[model samples]
Target: MTSKRVFIYAGGEIDPISIKSIKQDDYIIGADRGALFLVDNGIKPHISVGDFDSVNAEEFARIQGFSDEILSCDAVNKDLTDTELAFDIAIEQQPTEIIMVGVSGSRLDHTLGNIHMLLRGLEQQISCFIWDRNNYITLTDSTHIVEDRGYTYASLLALSPEVTGINLEGFLYPLENATLKMGQSLGVSNRLVEAKGTIHIASGLLLVIQSKD
Candidate 1:
């Protein structure tokens, strides 16, 4: 089956490159003030969702006018964050992959929470990642290939208590059947020397983060 990509934009510091990366057929969801950002950029969102607490009445009107559908909630009574709401809607679309942008910003709490959200897609066997101008983050439960996408560094961290039977190939610092434990910096600042690198893990969850300064 052909892959369906869903892009979710949250009310964080957005990368213009991410906005430009959207294709004609890719689905777009704007969360809260992200809706205003999309409409202001001349791209109408397929769906706009959130309590819209971050936007004023005029901005909210613009979002309503530009979005095909709006899922609104009470700002003071909602459980999930605006970004989570958008993520839920994206999952409902049964997308083969999901790319989340504008999810990382000055707010460390929200940024970390959004990073944990990748687990939701991982649990469903969907390819999911959080992308920003400076970082690309993904959680993996199995082996995978990583490409040199011009990022300065590739770091691997154990999301579970420990990731065992791990192997790293095509990287400047290769590993053989190693184990990575949570809170360890052993996998930090690794360089992908080849055109493509391999990350093979036997068990437990791992977070692969490609970042640049």
Candidate 2:
């Protein structure tokens, strides 16, 4: 399964502590500064896609020596960002899932851009997730199984404006055939009541966030 997974390291805030959850054999793609992050985390990226602008020459050389493939781009007048470019390479592999790290940080614009990548993957019918220390985010148009993995809370939001006939099983605050809207906070910060949690959606897309406070 690791060979079929693609792990993306983006040029955002990274905490090595959270990397323990990542599988060792997944194909790693480094986006700009993420190449350095990979080195710090004791892993060399399989493919690195980025312009050399963000990384210094010496460090870039070090990363190149460690990387299996390096894709260099221009710093000016680029259509896609470094992270987006990495996604292109990951998608080409036709993997089972794409897990992206170092995506959320102080840069609001970049964070929003990272989210668009998830939507694109979703359109491709590929499983995509943006993970951090406390958040495990995934989107689905149908039902999903949620199990207790030490996640303290769970939230469900309508990613497609209107998610109808929503039913949540084994949740502390269960919802039976409820309608979740885009601009609603009714489905935020709910906990699990059992070892397994189940969510059923009849129509529209749903974003499930299993998180720890």
Candidate 3:
């Protein structure tokens, strides 16, 4: 049976955590060269997406054999990025949660674009996360209970121009009805004092990042 969770892997910097998060029941999608990664790792993806311009004929053929479904488009004619195309497919299933992996890398534009894609989850009321070896990231517009998942630091940032009435509980540096403005580094490197911390925001979007060196 298909699970309520969807995991989309894109061509980028991958870490063990991203691969390790896969479970037997997960609906896995490989975008472009990401399919090669999955197939090489001995896992067949449910769907393979993108124009796959990054792969050679042999690799593409291997991905075709390994994937149950394929969604392809012309690389030059397509408007969406390969990762966004994979995300579009994932959103169609209306899963309870969507996890994006291998979307962050040396390319600053791609990384930031992927991060911005999390806003779609907030708009659709679906939980979304970007997972990497050293960082786990999500966005919220309201109250949220953040559990410490063995990460050493938790940070909050205002995704909008400003986030108002922010309150943090069980954090080493607690805030009370404070405001956070974008372009400020005041919220960086906070630690969870308790096993679970609470972040409440009255208005605007906030990005929560849990990371470790």
**Pick by lDDT: which candidate is best?**
1
Cα miss at 108, model 2 (Å)?
1.6
Task: State the lDDT at 118 in candidate 1.
Answer: 95
TM-score of each: 0.97, 0.91, 0.95
In model 1, which runs have C-alpha deviations exceeding 4 angstroms?
A: none
lDDT of 3: 0.91
Per-residue lDDT tens digits for candidate 1, residues 106-146, read: 99999999999999999888899898889989999889788
Ranking by TM-score: 1, 3, 2
Instruction: Answer with 1 or 2, whichever has the higher TM-score.
Output: 1
Candidate 1: residue 186 lDDT (0-100): 96
Q: Candidate 3, residues 21-68: lDDT per residue as tens digits?
A: 688878899999888999999878999999999999999999999899
Candidates in order have lDDT scores of 0.92, 0.85, 0.91
Q: Report the C-alpha displacement of residue 36, candidate 3, in angstroms.
A: 1.2
| lDDT tens per residue, model 2, 1-213 | 434888888878775765676676688898888888887668878988888687888989988999999999999979998989999998998888898888877888987788667878888778888877677788887788887878888999887889999999999999999999999999999999999899998999888888886
| Model 3 residue 182 lDDT score | 96
Candidate 3: residue 55 Cα off by (Å): 1.6
Q: Model 3 clash pairs?
A: none
Name the weakest run of 10 consecutive residues (lDDT summed) in model 2: 15-24
